[model samples]
Target: MRKLLFEMAYDGSRYHGYQVQQNALSVAEVVQDAVEVVFKKREDIVGCSRTDAGVHASQYFFHMETALQIPPEAAVIALNNCLPGDIAMLSCTEIPPDKAADFHARYSVCWKEYVYKIWNSKVKNPFLQDRAYQVKYPVDAELLDRCAREFIGTHDFRGFCSAGAKPTENYTRTIYRAGVHREGDLIEFRVAGDGFLYNMVRIMVGTLLLAAEGKLKEGDVTRVLASLDREQAGITAPAAGLYLNWVSYTPFGEENPVK
Candidate 1:
């Protein structure tokens, strides 16, 4: 058996989510079906993360074991031909089976980056209507940036996460970077963190939006962090504006600690 890694991108507007479900089309199911067409057998494809419904991904990854010995580039082309128009495979690589194991071991992800887009114009752009959140009210970009800064570093993020999340002993995660910026009429909230809880990024963006709209005080984020209570946070932003930008891992050339 050989391990094949696929780097794929998809527009998630039409699918239920990444994971497969009964009576619903999903990104995973689409890819798995393509794999079955190529290999003529059931294959296990493991995704890096399970994005919620209506969420999108620009650079998502998954790994599967296959007995086929096709070249990586050929496999990519063949898979793309079989996949639906909304999903496309950017690249494929054959890695040592041990490398595949290393990729998943211990959740050693260095960080994950996500972008939330807001259309901050009086009239929404038709091109981005489905991709961005439409917020007509004037947003103070400077104030939103200040609010974003408060989320950096380790903190109990219970307030910023959604309810119904499984219990965890620790709610703290490190934010390597967090910033709010604008391009033309689009407001973008970009954050990179070691890990995130359910709805954490969306809630953080929602809280920042409240600050931008003058509904929440500038220091309210700090108080919310201290509160460690979900009710203190703003409403969970819509999932349509969220995108899994990328996932980073340790350099492949680095020496393996276990080897």
Candidate 2:
């Protein structure tokens, strides 16, 4: 068996999400179908992450094991050619059997970066309507940045996670970076962390915005963190504004990690 590590990106507007769903189209199903068209058949195409409905991925990783000995460059060409315009395969790497025996895409990751985009202007930009969360209320950019700082460092994120998410003893995760960046009217909230719970990033972004709008009081974020209560946090932001920005992976037990 030959293991193929593949990278792809998608504009998620037309699909439900990354995973296959019953009675709905998905990015993974579309990619697998395109692969079948090119490679005849392939199995065990494992995805690295599960993105929510309508959330975009600037890049995503998955793996497949097949008997075919297709070259990486040829595989990339064939898959891209077969895929629709919104989804395209970017790279393919064939791992030697010795290495493939141990590599698991999802568990080998060292960190992931998720970005949330917000269009804070009163006037909407037609181009960014689908790409960003547009809010008519005036946002205090500085306040948003200040409030986001509370999320930095390791903390129990049970308060930020959505309800009905499976209970786990280790709800703690590290936030290496969390901040707000503004490009004209487009405000981007970038958070890079070791890992995330379900809906964690969206809820964090929502809490920061709530502080800006006075729905949540100043220094309330620290209280929310200490309280470990989801009710104390802000509303969950819409899925359209969330993006799985990029995932940085490291070879197990190694000093240098690969992007």
Candidate 3:
């Protein structure tokens, strides 16, 4: 058997999330169904992340074991044909089984990056209404940037994670980089970390928004980080603004830069 890797991108507006559920359609379910149709089997594909409902992905990864002899490029085309318009297969390739393991494998990941988009304008743009967080009140990107800097480095991110997260799991995670920037009317929050808890990015963005809006003091971010309590954070931002931007891995100690 050969391990096949799929690179995919999806618009998450219509799906419940990236994971399959009993009564809901998901990006993973649709992609898995397409793979099943091509391979004539079920549960062959395993996704790298479980993104929340309405959270899009510019790039995502999954692996599967297949006995088929089709070339990787052909697999991409074939899968795209079967997938809905909103989801597309960007590439496909075969890799050693060890290389195909998710983020768990040693020397497998350098970092993971996420981008949260905010539409800061006097009026919401119809085109971006479903893709960005629309805030009528102006946001100071510099202020948000200052707040984001306080979150960089290792910390127990409990204060930034959703209260709905399972209590059994640990909330500590290491953040390598976190920053905020502005482009035209868009305010972007980019964060890179070793791993993140459920709804962690959204909650972080919400807290930063509060800081940008002057509702929360800039120093509050440090207080929240030190608090280690979920209640110390602001509300979770809407899922529509969140995107799984990229996954990075290092093998042979070579850095794989994310675009």
Candidate 4:
């Protein structure tokens, strides 16, 4: 059997999430179906991460082991032909036999970056209806950008994660970068981290929104981190606005920082 790593992007508005579900459509299920069509047999695929409904991914990855001898380039074309329009296959590579055992879609990831988009205007853009969150208020993106820096470091992020997440022993994660940017009426909260807890990025965006509206002061972020209380953080930003911007398996550094 040979192992192959694939990159793809999808519009998650119609699927439950990335993983398979009991009775719901999922990105993985669709990809598996496409795989069966192309390879004439179903193969289990391991995804890099899970994303909630309505969240989109510009670049996502998965890996699978198969006995098929189809070349990687041919497999990409075949998979694309079988996949629906909402999902597109980008690239495919065969893992070297020697290192394939140690490579994993999820575990081998070094970091991931998520961006939450907000349409900050009284009039919501029809084009971004399902693509971005509409906040009918004046959001000070600059102020939130300044406040976002507080999240850059290792910390116990239990307070930012939503309640009822499967009990995890380690809540500590390192944030390499967190900041807000705005262009026209679009506000983006981009965060790159070594790992993330459930709803962590969304809650971080919400907290920044609270800061923009004066509900949470800049200094209060440290207090929230120190308190380790979920109640201290802001609301979970809508999933529609969230996007898995990019993922990196390369060693992070000043020259190749997570973006």
Clashes per model (N, Cα, C within 3 A) = 0, 0, 0, 0
Against the hidden true structure, what lDDT does model 4 obtain? 0.89
For TM-score, the strongest prediction is 4
Evaluation by lDDT, superior candidate among 2 and 3:
2
TM-scores, one per candidate: 0.92, 0.94, 0.92, 0.96
Model 4 scores a TM of: 0.96
Q: Per-residue lDDT for 149-252 in model 3, tens only? A: 88888888878777677874677788878999999999999998888888999999988988877878878898888988777788899999999997765422
Candidate 3 similarity to native, TM-score: 0.92
All models, RMSD in angstroms: 3.0, 2.0, 2.6, 1.9
Tens digit per residue, CA lDDT, model 4, 1-259: 8988999999888888888999999999999999998888988899999999888999999999999999989999999999999899999888889989988989988989998999999995988977899998899888898889899999999999999689899999999998899999999999999999999999998888889889988778878888899888999999989999888877556355221
- How far residue 103's Cα lies from its native spot in candidate 1, in Å, is 2.5
Off by over 4 Å in 1: 105-108, 251-259
**Candidate 3 runs further than 4 Å off:** 97-110, 251-259
Candidate 2: Cα lDDT at 83: 86
**Whole-model lDDT values for every prediction:** 0.84, 0.85, 0.83, 0.89
**Candidate 4: residue pairs that collide:** none
1-259 per-residue lDDT for model 2 (tens digits): 8888898888888899999999999998988887787778756578889988889999888888888878989999998888889887888878667878877778767788888999988897888766899988878777788778778899999999999688887999998888888888888999888899999999998899888788876678888988999998888999989999877776323465543
Assess candidate 1 and give its lDDT.
0.84
Angstrom error of the Cα, residue 114, model 2: value is: 0.6
User: What count of clashes does model 2 give?
Assistant: 0
